[model samples]
Target: MAAESDAPERGAGTEKLWNETGIDPVELHLGKDSGYTLRAYRMSDTLPGAKAEEPEPDEAEDDDEDAPEAEADADAVPEDPDADEPDPADFEDEAPEDGDEEEDALDAEPEEVPVFLTRKGKLLVFREPAALVAYVRDNDDHDLAAVDEYADLQERVTEDDIVCDEADIYELDLVVANLRGGQEGWEPELLIKAAEVGRDLGYALKNDSIVSALAPGSPLDDLDEAFRVVAEGGLKGRFAKRRLKRSDPQQAAIAWRGVIAKINDHVEWRG
Candidate 1:
């Protein structure tokens, strides 16, 4: 009876807002700073203003046309009249093979990626829930405002509604420490959550270092996969754990620390 009484106190009423909108609140703890922000995922081709920007033509090409032409060298070798003429077939466009077309289609598929509430490529986070609510309600300039559900959220959300689920709360501060503690002391779930958020932020912030560090074949990704395997608990997991034992703990800790620092550099805290 006592635990059930904290429904509104736990912001249960506001949970539906996120559920329906498919946008979630996330609490990020960066050791020295912590804040709340909104994040969502969408297909790359479906995101607002997602069109590719074409590069402008270079002025150097035009300058070359205006410059005086170089004089032909008198000492140059004369062309042989008997030489075979170049084949016109060489310049013709070749049709792609069936397998090549299939590969192209696969490569062109739109990927789903995280998008944060941001203003001018900088994520907008607030130290206080009220300030985050206020920022959401008052500002229409951010990337989140482009969503169809954002208007509904703006009208409905309050400071109390800004409360996030425990699952969405990430304690990145503890990542490096946990890694340096060695395989036996590592917490699988914590490291998994850190990887999830790190990947999301890597996409949201479009930071090259984060993307490369957390890429599918990267060392950090390998560590994440090893932790995932250990958490599953099976014969395969046993082998994965053995592999993890052989891995260097300090190297992983350093890599994660560098990624955390890169993320910290892009953060802008309000309130």
Candidate 2:
């Protein structure tokens, strides 16, 4: 009888504390034999604060415990710009692989696409060696291997690749024009390679001439301009003149100066 009388007073105190602290009680009902048990936690824990998060290392401080959440919330956001940034070391690591890929690509002797991009990438497209050989003679397809062997003469003969002749370069220019999609101007590397092909074939100014001819003019005039350049002296001519002069003393002073001018004329000139 005495314990039952004390229950009301205990209940009153509990109610008062709940009101003061704004904490709700969760009555977890156990088995009927166990009866019910009441547990209390801050109401915020189950209400507006349910989604509240912890702070991150880089966040600033704030008075409210919830305020620390602002920093945490910001941290959840993604930094997209940082995603695109690359490590400098990546290029160094990839360089050897890239070189190997290039060598394999070359050695694999993939059929050249005439100005058509390689499956590897856009930068690798050139006048297909087969096509260049074919351009010389229709049946040269059988002879392409021989032509390629001839083209490689620079490596064996001069320690460097020879340039392509103008006729062949013109064919390459045609191939470049036929390329389904590519930037419409001549790339210097392409010019250099064309010249190499010509040199290998024993055409003095053919490749360089073709390259100059392909230089872009107005939107519609590019192809026509290329034709003119091929007929006239293009970079190939300039390169050939310089080469001839370098090999010959009489034309050395004039030829070397011209070569310097030609080198300067091309954007690839480093010296």
Candidate 3:
């Protein structure tokens, strides 16, 4: 069969469909908001009456700094009787100009450097991701991965291949240059270096291993001397009696388990 007229002619339900598509029958009839329209205009027929939102009132000034510096300046400026002071009227005009410029500069977004940071000693070093990448690119001695590795540190540590933020580089460089004494000594310096490399990337020290290493009497003895006394005592009494020593047999047992865990988590035991 010949294709019957597949078009909406002049005056069928065509006008109704066109309205839905944002095309008004009258060319310049304003107010047409339709999903299909090329131009966004709200049709008067579809709109509902509603009051406009009122602008909010100015907020109360902050005690710390939200108060304009002009007020502070006025309060702070001393009355110099001997010295010829500038005109007060002139000061008002100058204040707004200076304040406007300062406020403009202050209101402007800060220049954001692409980096993160963590602390080592008294210094906050730029952290990994951006800082590490930049450091590795500049220094021939360190690789990218090593830079990443060192930047991850958080606590007591040491690693050879590391990158650091400027503050850390300064602090660690100075500390290592002039070694000192105390409980930290070498360990602290080492940890400082490690923090620069990657503070977070650390072998989680099993508290048990530390406890075991700290055993009394002999340097070699892994168990605390109190272990024997506690072992002799019943569990509760043993735990209660422990002051400077291990009293909980269960905790001791846990430490033994920690030794095993330490061995498992150790990075160098595969061979």
Best by lDDT: 1
Where model 3 places Cα greater than 4 Å from the true spot, the runs are 1-91, 95-107, 119-121, 124-271
lDDT per residue (tens digit) for residues 87-190 in model 3: 78875643467777887876453431112221121112222324433442344331111223322332212222231212222122222222223222223333
Error of 2 at 76 (Å): 63
Whose lDDT is higher: candidate 1's or candidate 3's?
1
Q: lDDT of each structure?
A: 0.84, 0.30, 0.30
Q: TM-scores of all models?
A: 0.79, 0.14, 0.15
RMSD of 2: 39.9
Cα displacement (angstroms), candidate 3, residue 166, comes to: 17
Residue 58 lDDT, candidate 1, scale 0-100: 73
So what's the TM-score on candidate 3?
A: 0.15
lDDT of 1 by residue, 5-36 (tens): 23233445677888888788888888888889
Q: Please give the lDDT score for candidate 1.
A: 0.84
